[model samples]
Target chain A: MTDPRLTPLAASLPDTVPFVGPETQQRRMGREFTARLGANESVFGPSPRAIEAMQAAARDVWMYGDPEAHELRHAVAAHHGIAPEHIRVGEGIDGLLGLLVRLTVAQGDWVVTSEGGYPTFDYHVTGFGGRIEQVPYESDRVDTKGLIERAGWTGAKLVYIANPDNPMGGLQGARAIHEMIEALPQGALLVLDEAYAEFAPEAERPEIDPTDERVIRLRSFSKAHGLAGARVGYAIGPAPLIAAFDRVRNHFGLGRISQAGAHAALADRDHLAHVVSQVAAARARIAAIAHDNGLAPLPSSTNFVAIDCGGDGAFARRVMTGLGARGVFVRMPGVAPLDRCIRVTAGREADLDTFAAALPEALEEARAAP
Target chain B: MTDPRLTPLAASLPDTVPFVGPETQQRRMGREFTARLGANESVFGPSPRAIEAMQAAARDVWMYGDPEAHELRHAVAAHHGIAPEHIRVGEGIDGLLGLLVRLTVAQGDWVVTSEGGYPTFDYHVTGFGGRIEQVPYESDRVDTKGLIERAGWTGAKLVYIANPDNPMGGLQGARAIHEMIEALPQGALLVLDEAYAEFAPEAERPEIDPTDERVIRLRSFSKAHGLAGARVGYAIGPAPLIAAFDRVRNHFGLGRISQAGAHAALADRDHLAHVVSQVAAARARIAAIAHDNGLAPLPSSTNFVAIDCGGDGAFARRVMTGLGARGVFVRMPGVAPLDRCIRVTAGREADLDTFAAALPEALEEARAAP
Candidate 1:
């Protein structure tokens, strides 16, 4: 019998995940990680109110979620002081990025992003057969001028950048982002992934016009709000661009419980503030731990810090592997010089204690390895 | 500044939802749906065990859901006596269909389906720029032979059918489905959407080889499992086809609570049997109500009954609108002949009581309308 034929594009695409979850590693190792700091998920729990809301909503799981996600969208809009039309809630920033790529990047279309940026975005672009033009980071930060230049050169349809950037924990000021937006090539849309926006300094959080037609800003409840498992994220952009998502997105993608939790989480300003403060404290602790271990920790505007391992990518990989073998979960950037640093999420006291204990032994093993 | 440019295909598509959610209607009416029977959700509700599992998972929403969904996939595999490699879990059958279309149907590729089959499947195909070759339903059921013929004629890449079909609650026997699978055009993949599989007679549930390369059976927790809001669905197919999903899918699409709920729901066979019984009783009650109102109710193998209004599409539409006005939320097929019937989901006794009370008045108003 003839097998079902996959589209040539689908067939050509490699079967790989953007990032392997810690659970998979746990299963492989037959043990759980002592410090669950990998994947940059907030180890801090979601707001108590969000937890209550999700638990309550669980019993009402018979009905499909509101396809429009009306309440959450409105609440997010009110919080941002933007019209509801400016918002489009989706499964997560990942899901939304996939839809965004599908909407803009046709086969062989050019797209631009920083080298070793969010792998998921690159995965989506590649899955859709879009050619990615990667610009190297300048001093561990997203090279905004380089991205603009690449987009202009390639006539790229989409340009992606994460403020308080992933892997490197580098921050580009709001002024830099606004300048980048203004400098975007005509017809090129900037996909500003602000997944860590809530963790950034308020002043550094770009205050782009909600109605900006050239850029779409994505925010997630995953990092600071601590609801990554709920898969709630939203994009803010021009009404037309936001509405266009409705054409191709899974209308009922968000779960009812997720919507309720995110809505409640948004309303609980106190919990958010508390988590931010806790993260700040944990970040300081992590930096101190790195210093004590004779490593340099990068300044982070997000929940995770990138600690330079004072070695090359291979040495950092060995250290990461050693940490994993020693029951600590952490990750490093996929490409160098970013990969010269190992990324560690700011965890609670006990979690960080485990990380701190594991780091020295892992570093010793890495140095002794061939 | 120039607006973001949508791909030519995306720009060509019209902004439309496959189904207008009851929540949307509720908002416009300034009232909640008294009985949300429109979406074919199991109002009988999910298993208590599932609810408990979800509630417990709610607290752990800080971490992203297991990207591989290993545990849930294994449990589902064991339930069906199939290998875990055969299953690919996704957000919902709607989300899965979109991915399937993307994997197989490139631009302008032909896809065959019954004219008034699942509109969401058609929406996915259209979103991916596939040209649909819709065969008319044979009687009230999907025309399997016609679908095969159409696929052969058009060299369609995909052929879609919902077993124990939606919108018009019809079932094709297992033998027929097996034959249809055998007769599928060489390169065409049969998308057998068995969303209502548990509602169908056991003998009617096709026992296709799990390794069948020509067909992929899509199942859902949304219907009989009563977890529509959880958005968990799986596709069982050839291992290669299943693995290919990894190339383009949102790896962490399923929320943690949703996975827990669905896994628990699957383990509680007693709860599934109980829901099937309840749905059967509700279907009988719904059919009786249609008969009492002098309408013909089609034999239902699914959680809904499509009651023929003994009129054309326009008249049936009026009946549906009248029912809506009376706070009885229901839907109808979107094409001719099939559109002559209104579809009502099986709801709880109390909910069906409201439907029973409002049917006659709705019929009267529909008849009175110009």
Candidate 2:
């Protein structure tokens, strides 16, 4: 029998998704992998203070989270030198992205993202029935001009770009992105997803004037903060726009313990800096391993490195599959030239050594695969 | 300059929301209230085991939560005797509600709900641009036939009913809801929100099979489970429907500590039973208090009591304000009729005494206020 409650629009949408969790794949494969490098999650862990806060609050999980996310928002606002009115904390950037899509895009509305940018953002745009238009990455960087020109051409309402961009681990200077933000078509919003911002060179963070409308920068605790498991992300924008989240968000939806943990995490700026250093160190180590294996590791400003596989997408797929078969988890880009690379997250020393050992063997196996 | 990014449909939608959180009110009031009984959160809290599990796992916040929520889903499926594929976990019922709206409703899509059922559900539908068509409750029970008729009349793609419903705390037996579901419009989906199900009589729960594609059931940790701060909720339905969540949901969105806590909470059936019993006792005590105060408390199956103020919405508003002013943070219904009653959540004895002491005075003050 057909589902009777689905609207025509829901019915019309396809059931395909962008990424499947490694857990699902594990279930399918009936075994867990050894080196977990696939999803770009930090294996280094969160601050002791954040962890302690969550643990302490866990017993009190009986209370609903502070709906206003009061203390966390204040801490975040104070940290950024902006008023709390300028911030809205969410489940994650992914959650915020979905909410932003719902708030700003309607069915048949045009939303733009780079062809090989974050797939989750594109998923949100399409999920809300927004028609997606894309700009391919140029020289391993997201072409902000091309995105703006397309936005103007399609009259798109939203555009997504990850600074310290993902997969390729490229960077765009603050001045250029800020200039692009200013040039964005009137009425359109710039969604700067800075999931990897903590790792971005200091100069790469676009100097966002708090009063600037038409742009909302998304930040996450998942990367350098090492709280990926907490699912904390916030969007920074003009007050009126930030307030719109209240109009549509899951208000009492935050986890109380998670909120306390995030608040403490944000307060302990020292922890964040330490994690940042660890990430930089991991990146350097990962680059060395890729070079030793004769694969070219792209310059990265993020936690993960994408190693050019020296062949086509199919060859890269073979390499990824070979590693998986040997119990190492890694991911690859979705499209051509980009797909000729495999994305590996920075992990602990043991994990890195596993990846190091697996690479040459996997590459040889892929080269020999029929 | 305009927000060139927001869609025409988004531009048409208002930025104002129906619910302004109590925290925001607290901030506006410039002081914290002594008793926070406004939001119907369980103040007693979750099981110690659940708390312990979450706290213990807190330090591992660097690893992303299992995107599939594998362990948690399996636990829920086992608890309900359903296949793991039949359950979909999300941020919260509010978050699940948002996803369900997107899954079923589109702009101009017909959606049916009780006039003042759950405002959050309606909020989600409206956010997704669905046109809400409300039917009045009969004798405070959601007029099942009225909803079915409205669904058929408007060809509503989705219909929502909360058993042991919010605001009113009214209930309908499985047989009644089953019949309604049977006669529901072809292809019209039934959304049974059982947030308060643990407090509900077992007999009142619908015996519908989990694999039934025509319906979806939602349960929350925010209620009796007392993990409201954790933001864990699940939607149970057929494999195809559950699979649909993967098509759009943020895979790694659920937080690590939350996932661990919810899994533990689900496993501790004894704790759940204890909570259910305590809530029942509290509900009885709350009802008795309403009677002692010369108000008619609606018989409830949930954790809160709705005490009829023997007047109109304005009188109930006074009672709420009186309670608020005197440090008893009770709330009243939003719309008319139901607004004739003040809603009070079950709290500790001291909190109840505070309510008892504050009521008449608040009432007197309301009577004297211009």
Candidate 3:
């Protein structure tokens, strides 16, 4: 019997996830990793208050979460000193990206992004049948001017750039981003993914007007607030554009426990500051470990450091495989130049110690094999 | 500045939620309801073991939920005596329905369903630019033969029916549903939404093959499992259809806490049995209360009772408004025949007592009004 026919778009799309989570890797390996330093998850953990709120919310899981997410929206808006109409809460930045693409992209529409940028964004665009016009990174950072030019040139519907970019952990200044926003084509949107925003310097965060129609900024609790597993993310955009999300989003997508945790996490300013400082310290230690092993660590603004493994992509892949074999879960970029380095999350001392102990042996093995 | 252009399909869609949640009304009313029996949520609550599991999971919210939902999938599969490959977990049945529509329904693709069926399903179809061909219910029950005929006639890509259906709380025998499945047109998929399946008697449930390519069954922890707020739902289908969900779904949409709770809740068969029994008792009590108030309660196999107020749609709407005014939250169906009744959820003694006391006053007020 013939299988049910998929939509032409769905039929053409490969079954893929943006990232193969570290847990899947561990399960395949038949053991848990000694150091969980991949995926850029904050190992320091969520605020104690957020944990309490989640535990409390657990008892009330029988009730459906407020479809409108009213209280959480209000809290998030207040946190940014913007009206709630300017924000929309979703499962995570990943989910929001999918919605944004759905709202704007039609079949064969053009979308622009830096090559080796956020793969989830690319996944969303491709899933919606949007043609991606990729601009290569320059000097190991997302080339903002090149992206804007490409968007304008192709009349792209959306341009996605993760500020304090992932995989490489690089930051572009606010002024450069503002200029890119100004250069956006009339009908195009600049999807400013600020998943790592909290980790960057304040000045590096663009001071875009919340009501700016050309740009929508995404924020997440996954990094600094340490709730990656909760999957809470919100987008700040123009009121009309924000309202458009209601047309396509799953109204009850946010879990009740997640909403409660994010609400409490937003209220705990001290916890965020503490995590930021802890991440800073961890970055220094990770960089020190890289230097101790004679590897070059790239300067990073976010919670992870990408260490150059002193070889090609194949060599770096071997190093990553060795790390995985040694129970240290780390990742590398999928593309060239970026793939010469291994990315490690900023983790606690114990996690870093495991990584430090594993790295020398793993590198020696890779060198010997090559 | 010009707004970012929405795709033509997204532009034409209305900003609407399938159900205006009780919380949204409460925020507007500026007071909490005395009883929330509108949404069919189990006020009996989830298993204590599930709650404990969620509480523990909250501590590890820093990490991302397993994108594959491995343990949860395995547990769900084991519960149903199916291979794990046949199970695909999602944010909720609502979310899963959205993905199903995305997978099958392209622009202008035809989808068939009951006229007053699950509006969320319609919402997803329209959001994906699919045309809906709605068949009216037969005597307050989803018209199985009529839906299949329509699906066959229109060459619909998808057909939706919620067994132990919502809004009306009606049931159809397994033999009838099996006949409908046989009648489904080739290339058309039968979306069997068993969101309220656990509450239905075994005789009322259809015994379909788990690997049936012609049908996909949706199950939820929202009803009998009492974890609606956690947003866990799964689909049982042929392995190929189940695998397609990975292409479009938010990999981490289900939160870590939710996965843990659902896993624990699945194992707690005792909690589920207790809830089912409690729901049965509450349904009886609600029916008696309806009879005492000189209203007619329809025969129900699910968790809610639809009480006919011996009036037209307008009159029943007035009664619903009166209930709301009296701080008792309840909902009535949106269309005719069905709209002549107000749907009330099965609640605890105290909650039903509140409903019992408020019903007479609400009826009196509605009768007294113009």
Candidate 2, residues A1-370, lDDT tens digits: the string is 3354555655655666677778777888899889889988877777798888888888767777777788898889999999998999988888888888877887788988898888888887777778999899887778999999999999888888888888888888888898888799987888898899988888668888876887899998887777888888999998877877776777776677878888888888787787778878888998998889888999888889999989999999999998888788999988877999999998888988898888899999998988
Q: Order candidates by DockQ, high to low.
A: 3, 1, 2
Model 3, B1-370: lDDT tens per residue?
2244999899898877788999999988989898999988989999999999999999999999999999999999998888998999999999999999999999989999998788899999999999999999888889898999999889999989998888898888898889988988998999999999999988778888888899999999998999999999999999888998878888878889999999999999899999999999999999999999999999998999999999999999999989998888999988888899999999999999999999999999999987
DockQ of each: 0.69, 0.61, 0.73
Q: A159 in model 2: Cα distance from truth in Å?
A: 2.8
Question: Candidate 1 chain B — worst ten consecutive residues by lDDT sum?
Answer: B1-10
Runs of candidate 2 with Cα error greater than 4 angstroms are A1-4, B1-4
lDDT of 1 by residue, B95-158 (tens): 9999999999999899999998888998999999999999998788888899999999999999
| Pick by lDDT: 1 or 2, better one | 1
Task: Chain B TM-score per candidate, please.
Answer: 0.98, 0.97, 0.98
For residues B211-314, write the lDDT of model 2, one tens digit per residue. Answer: 87788999999888888888899999877777777656777778888899899888888988887887787888788877877889898888888889888898
User: What's the CA error at residue B127 for candidate 1, in Å?
Assistant: 0.5
Candidate 3 chain A, poorest ten consecutive residues by summed lDDT: A1-10
